[model samples]
Target: MPSRTSRPTRRTALLCAAGLLALPRLQAAPAKKPLPPPPDVWPRPALVPGGVARLSLGPSATRPQAHSGELPLLVVGDAIEWTALVGIALAAPPGEAAITVAAPGEAARRVPYRIVAKKYQEQRLTVSPRTVDLSSEDQARYEREREHLAGVMATFSPAVPAQLHMQVPVPGRRSSSFGLRRIFNGQARNPHSGMDIAAATGTPVRAPLDGRVVDVGDYFFNGGTVWLDHGAGLLSMYCHLSAMDVKPGDQLRAGDAFCKVGATGRVTGPHLHWSVMLNRAMVDPALFIDA
Candidate 1:
């Protein structure tokens, strides 16, 4: 007996044909492109009224003859209630003023910052007689020290990156506040330029962020001092140290031990005087730290 020839059922044939027709159409569809990364959101930390933003200033802002050195960059914005980070750039002689923004039509704007340069007068003190006396020789010494410090401050590279996080150099209660109206011996003096951390002698002082030691010296007023450049016109100074563990050009990391607290300079007691300077203007360091 001849077996019945197998044949394709009409329903099965139609289904197969339809599937074959769909294959080409599915393959012809366009491929999907990838999505872009998200935009950066800045942390809105509360800033003191008239507080300056910490940022880097590039080498182009400084003298061209010197291929290397840091230029101090300070940020001063119009006094406003909301907190925002401002970027600043300085142009050489024939300086033109203009406001630039990251986006067009944005309410936030940058304005021309007028920085007035002032010459600081130096006073000398004699330890033996416990008198604040200025001798010709002492005056000369003070002038030399002042010049050296000014040079160091000038070398601050505006190219160095700003510190993203800040911590107290040592665990202590804050005493003398930064920018306080300070009077010494019945005479009004310049406002306090740095924050004073009241800690016992020998307390370890740490760096608040990664940076390079730009200057270190013992001065008549600052006592033992260390300045760290954390890029772009942002520099940190630690003074009145009993001991210094780092020197100029030494690289340091955030929270690294840099010195020990002391009352080395003209101070009441052992404490860490921490300062942040932008474009030579002494600004409050607390604005950058979380605590």
Candidate 2:
């Protein structure tokens, strides 16, 4: 019953659509996805105890996958040659080793590697009997702390770090070096797992690189400890702190104050125990230092 004008003929409808199109339009363009941060220039890693090995996967048209037994490799590169950074454990015996490399649609290849023996100096220390001979409660507490730390060190993210050259946390003399076979209280203990830097108590400790605080806790050995996750299975630990300035889930940039160095834990004097972890294994921090 409507009029012909209300019903609209094809010509009229076309005219109306033309007018609608002439009016101002409100539409948004599709948002662009953010690109990942640029990868850092690869550092040369040594393949010895407490060292990092930079193993090449050869030139390939695509990225390759590599692993050493249960440990995953951090591979970096593109359509060109790719390399892997392998963290050698201090306890690893020097001998021939191989890493399994696999490319898409290709069989995995176990490339042989050699680990040369490195002599580490020994240090004798006289510490408290309670530290050397742990009580039942102390042993239980250490085990619990150890479990918690293992979880922190096991963090693996696909994000590649923006930088590898690290800044010195707190300026101090490198006192107790890494991998020192220490005879403590006449009993042999595990080789030094981290570097001991002699710094004054209450001295501010900064983050060596960009990272997120994954853990902050107190322990029998590493008192007032803090763990930073630097993406791609790279972790850094700051132990024996006098005070912690950051907490879990906090973001930190390179040289940002994180805590204060202290002699807390099982140390004789004030120092910072700096440990660099790659693929859950503690490796040498010296490898990151720029020459």
**154: Cα error in model 2, Å:** 1.2
Query: 164-240, model 2: which lDDT tens digit per residue?
Result: 88888888899988889999989988889888889899999999999999999989998899999988888999999
Model 2 reaches what TM-score against the true structure? 0.83
Cα TM-score per model: 0.61, 0.83
Give candidate 2 regions above 4 Å deviation: 1-42
Q: lDDT of each prediction vs. the true structure?
A: 0.62, 0.87
- Candidate 1 lDDT at 40 equals 29
The residue-by-residue lDDT of candidate 1 on 21-93, one tens digit each, is 8786545667788888764222222223224432222223222111111332333222232222332221112
lDDT of 2: 0.87
Q: Going through the candidates in order, what is the number of backbone clashes in each?
A: 14, 0
By TM-score, how accurate is candidate 1? 0.61
Poorest 10 consecutive residues of model 1 by lDDT? 60-69
